[model samples]
Target: MNLLKSLLIVVIGILPFVVNAQSNNYKVRKCFGYQRDSCTTSANIFYKLNEDSRSALFVKGQSSQTIVSIYNGRDYRISLCWDHILGNRMGFKILDRETKNVLYDNSTDEFATDFEFTVTQSRDIIVELSIPGESTLSKSEGNEELIIIRKDKEMGCVGVLIEHMITPTKGF
Candidate 1:
């Protein structure tokens, strides 16, 4: 009985780590899409695994945000990608941390998949993601309700790709 109890405790403790490891792999795959190496070569400022700006899981119609520091005089390319199975409706926005000003909203730009810009000052900015809700439709020529659902649970992996925009050196 004591041995069983010990094994049970060990399994319970390791469960979360295993789940998270799987999630990270899924998220990374989703991020790069068909071009796995694109993310690596493009991102000079990659976020660490399980870090604030790395990845997240969310259901449809949910919104989440993270803060990442941006340096002055350096341009950045902020890109967002999600589980392709979930469709292309996922996107993110950039907000100024201190004043809360609306810096960039993807929705306003027709849900752009990526954004590039240079910050004048160094500070933390909020990166907010939005996932559209699942669509529901009434059955045609039938009284039964029709609902579309994924084979897997309604969870999505969002990856924020942060790439540094290198500047060209000017000859004096």
Candidate 2:
């Protein structure tokens, strides 16, 4: 009976690991859609990332992107680039939303993932990206593009391309 009891305990411990391992089957990746002239293109990169993963801003020569947004149909994080910082410091202000809290703030431009915060649900958050002396705001009451994401192995995003504008003063 003692041997049987030990066997059951071992199985219980292994069960959790096994279950957690199953979650790895779903491949997590990021899709970046940028405009090439008047037409847009999408660049998909596959990796194992969680909802808490930092949104990819600039991957080497991809500095064309000014903002990085991520949402797993629920939790989300918004990141801005270094060029958007004003007065030598990036601005990250938490909006009055129904959920979410500020977690990381690299507004000083000392880190890669700048202005990282969590959200219980994805909502329109006011983000002001600009340079030291320039003022560039993406806020609008018109037609704004929405980004939606999901886990892999089940067909994730459907035409999720990002958009950006060229700030004359904001340099790479």
Best by the lDDT measure = 1
Per residue, candidate 1 scores C-alpha lDDT tens digits across 1-172 of 9999999999999999887555456445543332222333344444222223365555666677888888786677777767655576766788989999989998889888878786678999998887876523212334566656443556666677676654434697
The local distance difference test score of each candidate is 0.65, 0.33
lDDT of 1: 0.65
Per-residue lDDT of model 2, residues 65-94, tens digit only: 122344423323233333221123333443
Question: What's the distance in Å from true for residue 103, model 2?
Answer: 8.2
What TM-score number comes out for model 1? 0.59
Model 1 error, position 74 (Å): 0.7
Let me know the TM-score candidate 2 reaches against the reference structure: 0.25
RMSD for each of the candidates: 10.5, 19.7
